[model samples]
Target: MEKEEIIYGAHSVIEALKSEKSIEKIILNKGQRNEFYEEITQLAKEQQVKVSFVPQVKFRKYENLNHQEIIAFTSPVKFADFETIIESILSKKESVLFLVLDGVTDVRNLGSIIRTAECTGVDAIILPKNNSAGVNKDTVKTSAGAIFKIPICKVDHVHDALFYFQSSGIQLIAATEKTDNYIYNQEVNAKVALVMGDENKGISNATLKQVDAKVKLPLLGSIESLNVSVACGAMLYEIVRRKTQ
Candidate 1:
């Protein structure tokens, strides 16, 4: 992370939150409640920014800096507005191809997925602002500069985004190991949004219930599942193949 990307101190953090800055996460000193605690918590809740409570000793790492018990990490990339982007896509009368991620916290996995999504001609990538990984220096490096080419939207919740896509006439397809249906059997040529989940847990039950179709890649090896990035590539290429043929 860059130095300019970090904002600390109580008043400064609160102002940033109020101004609707793209905050990746906020770290608060554990067991230290101040006058601004309630206000900060409420603002974070409203903005859907993840907060982590850590020991005071963690603040010692910042020499010659007064953190005031709170620090907010700002995202390196500016997030595009989902509604605006969707409206533009629809105005153009183009088939919608979105990559929606649920609870995917791994930075590298997120970067890899973005890289593949761009190459596969996905319209945009959407993720929840609180639980998902934010684009940063490491993500940019891992993506090999693909992060700049693709538009990323960080919303408050993935379920809400799924509903928005469905209302706009896009089908939702989820990739999970729990599914008996294979990816090859699905029809991907129409307006569709492909949903990928976390590394350990597959799609959350709430989000799974909203999907129009759930498909899985066959696992013939001893391993039961593939890495999220590899699985994402497999699914995306399958969509491309179906569209062409």
Candidate 2:
């Protein structure tokens, strides 16, 4: 196993976060009571660092080290800011295509989406920082390194990106069955933001209400719904086909 560079001490971990270091994961002591731990927790979240609250016994191997009940593993990947990337894309005088993910938490599914999005000419991917999956080794491996080829913007909320896209003339097209529209029925052109929802729950009611179009793939088999990644790939390819033909 490849050993990870671990950061011990609460203050050191916070400093790493403040410096915008690529932190892969942070494991906190579930039983340890510390005033600074909560602040560290919040900072880890703001930086999109994966966090885990394991039992104190899990820290036995690190008993010789001063972990302060908080240990952070450094990663090599970093994330892009949602607004900055979108603004840059909007500044360009050309059509834009974005994939917006809402509450797709599985890393493998996220990886598949990124792979397909990259192949389908998606300009960038906009994901919610909290509910969506973050870049990790599993996602990287699953994506077959395509994760690095695409630009992923992490926003505070999915709707924040959707609203901004709409205001900037990018149509917010969602993949959901709640509407009567099909993906093939709409003429996707110019600036377009394709929104994919959760694995089981589908798109959130709030998001579905605000999107410019709620489109779904026609279901003909006994399967009630397609996997989120598969469904997203289908929608992306459909858009590409429409654009080409």
Candidate 3:
């Protein structure tokens, strides 16, 4: 990570948090309890920033510098405001085509999805603030710079975003293996949000409830399911095909 992408020292991290910077994660000395520790923890929680506690040995790389038992990594890309982007898309009277990700942590998969979404002309990609991969160097590279070209929105809770999209007349179509409905059989040409879930867990039951339709890709071979990225591509291209036809 670049020096500008990282904030070191307790005071610096606390200030960054106070300023509501887009911090990816914070690392602190494992057993060291300092005066600013509680304040940092509180601020991180309020900002929904992930905090990790590492051993003193882990700080050896910073031995030459004064890290003050704290380091925070800021996201390289600025996240978009979901509501603002949605409003703008609606104002243009354009059909909303959004890709909502739930608990997708792999940077490569996230990158591929972003690349595919951009190629597919998706309006925006929505992700939950927690448990989703942030736009970092690896993700950016994996996306072939598509991350910069697309509007990525991180929300506090994906379910809330689903609710808001539904209220705005965007049909929520969930891609899952648990459903009997197949994507080829569904109507996806209209304003819709395509939801892809965690690689292992699929869609959460609570989230599944909010979707207007749950569709799955048919697996006729030995493999039970396709990779998340490939499934996303198949689903998105299907939408493109439907719109064109």
RMSD to truth, every model: 2.0, 3.1, 1.9
lDDT of 2 by residue, 1-245 (tens): 22336898988998989997767678998877688888988988777777899999989999999888789887435667777878887798477789999999898999999999999989898877677775677777888878888788777777777788888888888999887888989988778989998998988999998888889999999999999999999999998888778
Clash pairs, candidate 1, are: none
Q: What TM-score does candidate 1 reach?
A: 0.93
Better TM-score candidate (2, 3) = 3
For 1-245, candidate 3 gives per-residue lDDT tens digits of 22228889988989999999889888899889999889999999987888889998988887776889798888888888989988998889667689999989998999999999999999899999888876677888889989888888999999999999989989899999888998989987579999999988888999999999999999999988889999999999998888778
Which pairs clash in model 2?
none
- Candidate 2: misplaced stretches above 4 Å? 1-6, 22-25, 45-51, 57-68, 73-75
What are the clash counts of all predictions, listed in order? 0, 0, 0
> What is the per-residue lDDT of model 1 for residues 1-245, given as tens digits with 9 covering 90 to 100?
23337889999999999999888888998889989988998999998888889998888887467889799988878888999998888788566688999988899998898899999999899988777877777888788888888888888788889999999999899998777999999877568899999999979999999999999999998998899999999999998888777
- The C-alpha stretches of model 3 lying farther than 4 A from their native spots are 1-4
TM-score of each: 0.93, 0.87, 0.95
Query: Candidate 3: lDDT of 53?
Result: 92
Score each candidate by Cα lDDT: 0.87, 0.84, 0.89
lDDT of 2 at 145: 79
The candidate maximizing TM-score is 3
